[model samples]
Target: MRFVLKHPEQADVEKIESLDSVKGTFTQAGQFQVIIGNDVDLFYNDFADVSGIEGTSKETVKDLAKSNQNALQRLMSNLAEIFSPLIPALITGGLILGFRNILEGVQIQMLGQKIVDGALAFTQNGAPIYNTIVDVSQFWSGVNHFLWLIGEAIFHFLPVGITWSITRKMGTTQILGIVLGITLVSPQLMNAYGVAGAESINTWNFGFAEVQMIGYQAQVLPAMMAGFVLVYLERFFKKVIPNAVSMVFVPLLSIIPAVLVAHVILGPIGWTIGAWISDVVYAGLTSQLRVLFAAIFGFFYSPLVITGLHHMTNAIDLQLTADFGGTLLWPMIAFSNIAQGSAVLGIYLLHRGDKKEEQVSIPAIISAYLGVTEPAMFGINMKYRYPFIAAMIGSSIAAVVSVGLGLMANSIGVGGLPGFLSFNADRWLLFGLIALIAMVVPATLTYMYGKRVEGNE
Candidate 1:
């Protein structure tokens, strides 16, 4: 307000045609004027440059001037849009990771973790660094931990939180955010096991479930429930309150009330959702109908990877670590993607191109091998279409076969060479071999097929 009033004269006045402003008197040589529309025309000769402001208010200026309010408003608007999807993504990943951490003990056991005592002695230096690194990693790993917490808090606790910010109907994505974030962060909670006797030396503790299932509620469910309120709050406030005012007011009023509801109600709801999804997927993947089931999962899975929905699998893994003790999904994508990349790239290898085509093919193939889909997708698979179909067919074959092998993943992260982690040597080796086989087949096929198209002889 002060900024607008102090420099009113310096701003060149614009005379946009007056609206029905009989009461609001224009006393001067109409020293100032206001126009409300897409474009403002300054009648005065003094007006030389065009300027814009963000907020709508009646401030008289001698010349058109860009106002800080407008800049700040635009910045806030841009940030909001950028963060909307990101908030959900962050929460879903964080919660799932939290859950995965909690269930690591059971997960480690299910994968038959061993050799910890034999691998290396956890003496003072080793012990401290190991613990410190793990803890520090957790802190840095989920910088979005708090953000997702906000995401969750709004979704589960504040109906207004969810409705105010977003208009879209809540569905798998919304639920998945709660599901995944719970999966990750829930696993991080304190899990203490009650040993049977004083001399039970082998008992281990998990972060969330301390030797029991009921305790999963204590740590994992709060954030899960928090997901609902935020979703609601988003819709409610977004309409009634201006974004600037809502920024401060939303957190203060929304957070406290939503948090209260979380502790009281939403925890069990989230747990149920997480458990149900995991159960259904595991049941499908493990059935005697594995081939059909796997092909279906495989077909959609890579598409998800292509679009980034594959992050849901990350949530599933976190839940896996917590509920059933391990994960087997995503490892297939590692093979399929690599295979697609290799096969498509084989075109470049077999190419006797006009240099330019070969150049394009080589880079596309390399990017695919590196597990980036765009160069392969937008570059080759998309351009030729056949290569993509070939890659998909190859991926499905590999996926079904991987399922048949009962391949499971104990290690985390997306598909790449590093995904070969020997943490569970038997499963790792079996899956690794299977993945290698899968990739080789498709790559060979693409290479052979691509040979005809290249060099035009």
Candidate 2:
């Protein structure tokens, strides 16, 4: 007789083979065929009854399952998975905003206008200033305005994308998610950005209570919580409703309760939570101890990336950008990226003579510089302990300088050399200086450490 085991174990198979009643046994995958002279039916019955072994309660099994699951890790992983697809859109919008800043924010002295007086000179502080592209050219101004269409879709209505992504990740009805997201940011409701300055908020008056007509807009936490609520409701309705009329009732049952619950309970709670977190982070970035905060954050960022905790920063960055117009935290993150890449560059130089090591190091260096550092980190830096230490030290130094000088990025952008484009126009030079430090310090330290280790060897 052949038997299939749900949770197959080699020890169980060995014990079964050792039985006196068994002649021989053959096993493949989870299935086993035993040649036995004893009664097969009796043995099968006894084995099936083993699950009822004394003193094991359902509560004990539940506790065992809970102990095995790392809830926080799973939550972070899910948040990462949900946000992965949105990164490209966010980067594109950030770069566009940066370009807009350059066109409008930077000022240049018009030397020729100073030479030729009264040539319709534009002056800032009595010096003749050259008109920016947006000022001089109607076409560029129009282009700047045109870019806002994409920016608005990506950032202002970000909740829509977040909800859709959550549905896609959770395997729910995506249309319901989309509709639910739209409700949170619909034009019928007051825009979240405008709520603070408004003299009065509009509300719907029910006989017993009143509901505020406010939108979530760019809020992340509320959309995430609401999306999951919709997902769970959809699943619950699908299970209880009959298949014949499930199409009609499931969506109706799922979306209505989900939407009501979102606006009534989850939305307010999520907003408070998101706002509180943003306030705390913003305070940390601007506090007297900010330099110390930056150093610690920069030093440990690489380790956070290894554990998948780095994904949480995406939400925080977005929140900071929404609340405070920019984020100081992301610049430090970019510096850490550059520092790790520089460490890998040191490894590449050390391994130039070895073709095999060069092949791995070259790609790792390029990837790390482009804002993806996993290759350089795990492949090169982590392999050589000194390189990782050198990177953390470099990153810490750069981050201290960043917070000290009050460096801030307009938005999240490419996280390596190109990251400077995302900085405030006035801080471009400062960002460049910090980037240089991030590169030079890590590379120099790593190379010197490697040479010393080689000499000892």
Candidate 3:
């Protein structure tokens, strides 16, 4: 339904009417594209400036855009604010892993085989890399052999490891000092987790971790021990003086004892639990129908998105990584998100519609651009009322292809922009390509199909 305002004193009224025919949205110049499908008019009209209480054309479009512009800028700024807290620990860990990958790659090339060859060249363009490679073999050999000599001492030191974004807060000078002081010199700490180096390693595989899984600390003993320790630690720390002032001595005082305790108690115990959890999942994944099971799991994966069951995916993924050193979830999910976004882009392009139809499709397209699919999923595609079948035809095809790719994720991250990094070095390139195919093929089909349906009032 095309609207023409007849000298309407309030131009917003004409906009309000013009967008009425949309699935539930609107577009307006110099303001946030209006979403007028619901009580949007009620909320927007509440704005004193837009309300036209004493309105005039002289009021300017800027008035219509005020609140939204503020909102958009704040969202952008807040995202920037979070970068410092998040980057160091996370990216540093990834860099270390990348270094490890480089070392492994060199070692495997020496043996003339690899667990996975990222790139191999016998003839790039036409001839051999034989002499060139042989010349560099010594360089590769140095990297390969040096990795094992002091890998942990250099790489896993708490100060260094904590530099990773995930643990940046933990690595702070203050926290480090506190942790060390309690662990060392505190006799009670030495007993709970076995004391020496070898004992520490065994405790991870057998001590607290084993006790939690088995009945070593019986039902009552386990619960009671947890409580008593918490109470004692809570009280013990309450009496302590701040150590930052004692800077020179604090590191010495805090660290020697804390390292002992963290090594014995926290790291090993956490590793044990993490390892145990990993085993349970790894066992399940590699069992009877590993591929088929993976495929089936991938199939159900899409719905977790719609129902918000996506968060639980973390544990499942942790297990996968523990078992396979990485797992298929990353690529598959990335494909899912990308395919859905592509389908939304499809609507924007192929949704030949009346002005109203165009209005709805455009904003849904906007949401998809920022990586929100629900607006497209629940609002338009499903409600397009005719092409529902076509979108599924796309999604299902994408799911099957994802299963085939054997796509794997080495580390975990979130949706949207961060997820783009997930595709790095993961074998999911094929799944990503499949998503592109799924989006284009089905989008074309859906558009052609929707084109044949009725346009609008």
The candidate scoring highest on TM-score is 2
List per-prediction Cα lDDT, in the order shown.
0.49, 0.82, 0.44
Candidate 3, poorest ten consecutive residues by summed lDDT: 212-221
Q: Which digits, one per residue and each the tens of the lDDT, describe model 3 over residues 69-149?
A: 346443333222223343344334433444545444323334453222564445547533322222356875576466534
Each candidate structure's TM-score, on Cα atoms with residue i matched to residue i, is: 0.52, 0.82, 0.47
lDDT of 1 by residue, 1-457 (tens): 1123344556532221123211011111122223221223322211333334433333233122224235544333332332344344433443344343443312222333233545632555554213222233466446535454653443223222222223223321343344323432333432212222334333235555333222232222334346556556545655678877976764555555554455335645666787787788788778888778878776666556443445456446545545654555666666666766766666566655645455445665666655555556544565566677667777787788888877766424445444554124445567667767767776777777777665465
Deviation from native of the Cα of residue 400 in model 3, angstroms: 3.6
Best by the lDDT measure: 2
* Candidate 2 local Cα displacement, residue 188, angstroms: 1.0
Candidate 1: where is the Cα deviation over 4 Å? Answer: 1-225, 234-250, 305-311, 451-457
The residue-level lDDT of candidate 1 at 301 comes to 60
CA RMSD of each candidate after superposition: 17.3, 11.7, 12.8
Q: Worst 10-residue stretch by lDDT in candidate 1?
A: 21-30
Error of 3 at 457 (Å): 10
lDDT of 3 at 215: 13
